[model samples]
Target: MAGKRTNSNLAGELLIELRRDDAVPLHRQIEASIRAGVRSGRLPLGSSLPPTRAIAADLGVSRGVIVEAYQQLVAEGYLTSRPGGYTQVAIGPEPAAEPVRTEPKRVPRIDFGYGRADVSSFPRAAWLRSIRRVLTEAPNDRFGYLNGRGVPELHDAIADYLNRVRGTSADPGDVVICNGYAQGVSLLVQVLVRSGAKRLAVEDPSADDDVRPVAVAAGLEVVGIPVDRDGVRVDALDRTDADALVLTPSHQWPTGGVLSAESRAAVLKWAGDRGALVIEDDYDAEYRYDRAPIGAMQGLAPDRVVYAGTASKTLAPGLRLAWLVVPRRLVGDVVQAKVAADRGSPVIDQLTFADFLSRGEFDRHLRRMRPVYRRRRDVLLEALRDRTPGLEPAGIAAGLHLVAWLPDDLSETAVVETAARRGLGVYGVGPYRMSGGGPGGLIFGYSTLSERTITDGIAMLAEVIDEVRAG
Candidate 1:
């Protein structure tokens, strides 16, 4: 009886154990063991239960005991008996495994980290209206899988908007909508590397951090060309064998140098001579405060440039909306890459954004946000000038953030960590560099902070800086 067995493999797998030495009755022990299996998901929904006689014979218990255990489970809804004479598990417990929970770490009260948008200012009423209108009016076909080139309506809207605002020659056919700027870079890098391109040049002390690793992962070498006040040093670019260049020409990130007209022309000339590509990251150009925004370098030579733009700064990063203006020759390959990445972005969001753009709400939102950000930028500049006389803040003329070059002796990490301890959030530009060595500087983003918060955070940051400088 102790060696009793069954032909059922599942019965063998369950290996139900009975404790005869314990105080519990045999029938009760069998019931408890099977019940634990069901609750723990060791017994799956719809799995056949061994026949009562077979189970009783295998466990060396009386057949009536097995029948009673089965009856109890059936009444408890854990097993279902069918008219066809099959008894199976009725309920399956959810898997107990989950990511372990931990205490939330402390966050700085005022975070100056870049790439953050003011979620509170996200024009919710306008967005909701756009969503409703799209849902009400979109054809049934709009919900189906789409071409990788994106929805034609969004392509047309983006083409018109960029042509008017960024001065780029974008034919509607040449635009490919992507999830965001990050995905756009990934797609482009994939295409470029597969096409036999070997090296890419990124501006040092640039916002190229996110894109560089993507390119390198695709088996291409990324070189760092130093950027000066006028933008990426083209004179130095001539020395590297880089086959493509990713630049923030309109407003250099972290550095804020608008690629000079001279530098812009030089880079294009360099590309043309080498038959190379220039990726123009036209990020945050719409927010320039001191002058009329510089026209996108893509406008100068669209055939040689790939223009990238995003709503991350203009609207919200949560929107995950961005577009690329590819040269006609590269459109097909870029579209293919996009399709393979995710079969294009979500269609409903694309349609909603198209509606938003067509209704002029996108432009209106930008207009409303410009003054608010400009005032904050002004406050930041003035505060830095008044309290931190030794630090020089540059890139203030444009973009949501600027870089303040610290004194040579002060380390960027020391100031950043001290500021965090004081409940202020800010970052150093050192991580953005491709190489270890660069100027000692800190980057501060003002788009998400209010005027009062900016003033207070800067005051606290100044004290931290003074402490770093003193010690």
Candidate 2:
């Protein structure tokens, strides 16, 4: 049995006896066994652990039981994750392997770093049909550079949708299309900074470490405004002459609380009082689980709020489609920023997406993804409550992933180390810091994962946690 897995004597199989005791939690016990497997190298370097479903099926236990166990392992640094799957022994017990090859940077298995649209359930078939019809009626040899400001029809369609749906004071003329939110973010920042707004206030708990740097690179000073449970505390605005602020008023990233009406009004009033501007990231706006989405803040104060959003969350990030709704006065400046940056995006993408949204396929896509994400959210909740001990997930109602705060004694580094050992792509929320301690937690993205994967993945995570707790 040199390199073969012998179920009876192997560490991965020792869990059968551990499960016999009903008093002990199955996940922790399973975790202990997995740890033994790693230490002994019965699960050799770069080896794959049975996924949660496989483990659950073998143990005749619920997948949630497995999810809890895996969560512990992820916390313990016994797993490393990849997109679509994770590897158990990829990181290995030691730096024992010799260099066998050289490679470019490995794309992360699960990219929790970037906020993405849950497009797994997008109405692709319907979208394809629309594209087919449009293409069929098109002129021959039709592949040419598109209109500079996006197709007229798509702009009109997006205008109608935004005004009706999000309640922004946007006409087709007011909207400037770009490749995605990042581009929109950069363009808007340049316009304001170029307009003499030197400093911009932002939330500490935010997704755009990129945006802040992007702003700086575009020649604006970045300032932090702490976010309260109700949203960015308006009172915390940097006490300077800064004239612009960036916020996700609808669903704040990472923490996932909507701006309270009081807070929302306060921010608007601040903008008005200071004659400042607001950069609104309407991120993950459509997928609300526990409550209806609070209407976009742009609706409340049209002149001061510069609304920005993208199809990255609702459709696929690959579409690279997003919009910036600047005040009528800022349009020329922002469009110029766009023109300078990339001479406008591929005209065809704008045409296709505008057609996609206008025909109502985009809305249909959102509706389809809502229930799927809701189910995944529920599964995550149930997994944590029933299986994950000492772990808590906040921001439950919306967004693709939930943030799980680790216990006070848990080391973020250890959690990361344990996850690497197991091939689980777990990340600490504050690990992205240029400076400062963030809430010690993992941002578990559940959108791209199937239920079984979520169940299994969480089980892997639970295992790391159990190992750490025992230590």
Candidate 3:
């Protein structure tokens, strides 16, 4: 009888084919199959192949043929192996084309970008301690899916902290944790739109450009009210037919003005009379150097005002943690929206932050950073006073940044461009305005810069202003 014919099939679903009658040797044929699989994207990079013994037994060939084929592919840079590890595909597929920019971006030597905190002071040790405690003490179920409103521990912690620090009458049941201020606003806007709100009003010349796009995308008409030294003008707000208003009462953006007491009362009254809602974005309320920060407006009328606060200013923006104290009637709607936006914010982070707040670590970190930021603000003001007397810094009593009025002779765009050419980063206020009638100015954020760096950047800015004026 003829000898038993050898099987031709390979195993482990590697998508390899063998030709028994071809003149080429079995080892070379196996190598070609693997090469074709890799080149045609069938075998992805970093994917492991079957063992030599398994493939040899399936193909009814000697193990040496399989070993030689793998060795050859390895030598050609298509496979990688170690003493005990499985061989894997080593080469990457061809790259796709990427879009090109008309002008290359320049990395500035002294950057004064706004909306950033001193990330170098993040209190990593305290955070690590909190995380360790959670892992050791928390129940196993804590790692699973959580309530959209947030965990009870974080809700209680945020409520207690806000009541004591921000003067808000927040109940744990009414607090909804969100990704950040951006998501907080987006969720609330969706709720408002669903409730038949047609128009929303915001501060003109506001630094927070994020709110407009979110509101518009959700099908709400956004109206702009002018802002002055006392914050958003109540007169302009009274004139609009807006069903809801969002403003930074404690420390306004870009302009850096605190809403006057009379105006705050008037705003609450306006909301009550019109049967509307007010969103109090209490961002950057912890760094007031002149005196104690003002209590949140939400304290006066909890049912009519929505209190929004975030860790981005006090801790770090990368945390993406924030809270909204909703009215009792609106809590359910907002939580439903939160569930739809994302199941909820990360639970581990929420628990870690709750532990951080409960142990008083959050308060201690803020106390340490308050003076550091205050000193940076003073140094920036002093440098501007000495180097560029023509520039006047406003809204310096609070927040991480302030706006300086540029002289009438120098154009805002011209000064910003000329400063960029000198390796300095400065932003103009005109772009933040809804309608253009205000004086030209530049916004300087000093929270992330050292005192020495602030001085040097101001000196460079002064020279750039002079050059622009001469031309």
Candidate 4:
């Protein structure tokens, strides 16, 4: 209802006319009011006219007068009748001054808009050194028709890396490289839906709006299962009907909470019982600051879990490389979908990345970045704590971004708008949101920030908060 008094949410508030003194004919008054509203551009062409009852109630006019006015307008080509809906303003009478299309561009002041790893913070020195060594040793044909899943070197490397770092037991051959987490999720969703699956369970307050949207578009129903501090609650999962469940077990988005052991066990048990699949998104495994890195949940229940990970958070998002470890049964369908989609991922980047992974360059770069990012995270924490007394950011456990909660009266979008006015770039934890009682906050990514920028940005944010409070 925010567009204009002209129209809002297609639920119009009409201006009608009636008479107490009888100075004017009632139908004539109504006609004049309608014409005035239309000519003033307050009532645009094709806007639904108010129901006769509504016009009568608002103006204290008889329905007959309003109906007569509408009928007159229709005959005059100002209004058009519909089967069961309100009378529409005729299309022909629109003024040239009123533009039909106007959509403003969005540029975030402090675009914390997406929860992604900042690649500019990447350890260039280590990566280049690894790339140099890899180039020297790599064979020429390594560039051609490599594994449809991934380059063999990187696939082997990822398997070894996951086993060592994430404790996943997935074989190298089982992993298929994708464009990103969303790509893998989309493909998997397609395969499942094609197999006659209908509803899929997902975290009620999870990130990744794209996943559910793809499912719904594919004629699959997405049921939101409640999530809590311990991650997706098993007891709360609706058992009515769902063929699969998507979860972020390592660190939940928006509100960062690792899945508890009991919940993990319960979910796995549920999936096992129903012959369902669990998609485990290990988005930010290496960014752990407070606890030991949680290994892949796929290791515990290999057949039931489809493990997905991405370079987006680890190395850089723009690289757009992700991989999924699926069950043996679904692997053929997923591979077919992969080939059918893009005829395989970009070969050069895959080979170069494979070279990067094997030479221990990925690890070395991670080592260099860890302390630097940790320091930046500390700066963010110190600034927020100092400037805003009671502000609390959730999910500091891992990842490039953290969510900072505002007071109940303040909204996340309002804070975002105010920040943009101040020329800062930031965003919510996810474009993803919930209907009720979801935490209200902004996603503050400190990785792309310099020491100077983090300090100045937080100070400016604090100032905006003060102004908003006073205003």
The prediction achieving the highest lDDT against the true structure is: 3
Indicate the worst ten consecutive residues by lDDT in candidate 1: 1-10
User: Can you list the residue pairs that collide in candidate 3?
Assistant: none
| C-alpha positional error of residue 119 in candidate 1 after TM-score superposition, expressed in Å | 1.7
After TM-score superposition, the amount by which residue 291's alpha carbon in candidate 1 deviates from its true location, in angstroms, is 0.8
Task: Return the TM-score for each candidate structure.
Answer: 0.82, 0.73, 0.82, 0.73
| Candidate 1, 355-407: lDDT as tens digits | 89988999999899899999989998888888777788988888899889988
How much is the lDDT of residue 377 in candidate 2?
A: 77
The lDDT values for all models are: 0.87, 0.75, 0.90, 0.78
Off by over 4 Å in 2: 1-114, 118-120, 137-148, 238-240, 432-435
Look at candidate 3 and tell me the lDDT of residue 22: 85
Off by over 4 Å in 1: 1-104
Question: lDDT per residue, candidate 3, 9-125, as tens digits?
Answer: 224546567788989988999999888888766677777778898888878899999999999999999988998877878886656568775787899999999889899999999
- C-alpha RMSD values across all candidates: 9.1, 22.1, 8.8, 16.0
Tens-digit per-residue lDDT, 1-471, candidate 4: 344223234434446645657788888878887877777777777787777877676677688978998999888887888778668777444556766786886565444444656677676776676567666767788666654576777778788888888888888878888999889999999899889998888887777576888988999888877776667778877463689998888888756778988778888888888888899988887888878888789999888899998888788888898989888788889988888788779866776787777777788778877887788888888889998766787778677777787777766776777788878776653356544567667778777777777888888888878777776
lDDT of 2 by residue, 1-471 (tens): 246333333436434445475777877778777777777765666565666776678788899987887777777788655656653554455546697887765444434343655566666788787777667755443356543456666679888898888877777888888888888888888778777878877887777665888888877878777775567767777354578888988877777778888888888788888999988999788888888757888888878888888888888888888888788888888888888888777755666776777778878877878898889778878888877767878877788877888888897778767766676777777754434876687877778777776777778778878787788
Pick by lDDT: 3 or 4, better one: 3
